[model samples]
Target: MNNQDIKAKETTKDSKYIQQHLANERTFLAWIRTAISIIGVGFLVTNLHFTMRSTLSPLGNQLATLIGLVSVAVGIVTIILSAAVYVKKIKDINNQTFRPPVISMIFLGVFIIIISLIFGAYFFII
Candidate 1:
């Protein structure tokens, strides 16, 4: 084989690496699905505010709308950030670079905490 062909073969990853890359793609897609679900929940909450106007106080409706908007914003941010992170990870993997998972983990944890607090406010304060 020519040097060019040999070099190309050398750079190509094996089946294991390909599997890992596929797994990463699956994970990214899962995050996208989660974001869509969050958006759907947000829309539902906003719609509820209008449908139950007679039963809900003005403040409660406003709170619900705010929560819904925030949820949607968060979901959009998550999708953007997650896609960026996924791309970075894939590049790192291909380059054989070590990447710490701390950042993504912390972001997800904080996101969950914030969502939990919003749920608490919705149930208790609203």
Candidate 2:
């Protein structure tokens, strides 16, 4: 066979959707990074509260603790959901039936808003 013919055969052996798969993987990694950041902030906030406990009122300390715990829970949930999303996307890509996950996007948006409001209230209280 000619060089072009051999290369075409090799290309066919690889997935035609390689680019889409790569993009999906990148998106998964981004989600993981976001989860880690959320977890890190949770830990940081909790530690900061402990560090400054002497100056904090009882209610302020409790609120900080609650916020930190909630942050960690949200991060954990994000990790799980992102993994699920990654799996679903892989299936969708392979089937050539990809569609944006609108519900997940809406849930994430609402979650962020709620978290921001909680943070804002906590800061306002302190």
Candidate 3:
């Protein structure tokens, strides 16, 4: 009904903005979880490959083991970078200075799904 009333309404909207920012934080946490899963899978692959090769094919086993290790290392790096970016994004959002250029999450989701499908098929099928 007055200037004070209008200001209160504006603050409420800003609070909603903050809520969305919290949602972003939750989403980033989810990303971290996915990263952990990815890293775990990489380790699992390395171990499983090594165990299967415990009795044969020394050279090929070593190569495959190295590749699995590399996958784990890459997963760690990816997670570290993602965390850094998430913190930067949160800062930008708090300053009200960033609008995402694209739905980065869409790509992320797609990649995760694809990985899941590939791994699932590999394990559950022949």
Best by lDDT: 2
1-126 per-residue lDDT for model 2 (tens digits): 999888877854228789998999999999899999998988887788779856798777888899888888888988998899888988888888999879978988998898898888877877
In Å, residue 48's CA in model 1 sits off its true spot by 1.9
Task: TM-score for candidate 1, please give it.
Answer: 0.81
TM-score of each: 0.81, 0.85, 0.58
Residue-by-residue lDDT tens digits, candidate 1, 22-90:
888998999999999999988997787678656787777777888799889989997998899798878
- CA lDDT for candidate 1: 0.82
Q: Give the runs in model 1 whose Cα sits over 4 Å from its true position.
A: 1-16
What are the per-model numbers of colliding residue pairs?
0, 0, 0
Once superposed on the true structure, which residue ranges of model 2 sit more than 4 Å away at CA?
Answer: 1-14
Which ten contiguous residues of candidate 1 have the minimum total lDDT?
8-17
**RMSD for each model, in Å, please?**
3.0, 3.4, 6.5
Best by TM-score: 2
Q: Please report how far candidate 2 places residue 121 from its true position, in Å.
A: 1.0
What pairs collide in candidate 3? none
What is the model-wide C-alpha lDDT for candidate 2? 0.85
Which segments of model 3 are wrong by more than 4 Å?
1-16, 54-59, 101-126
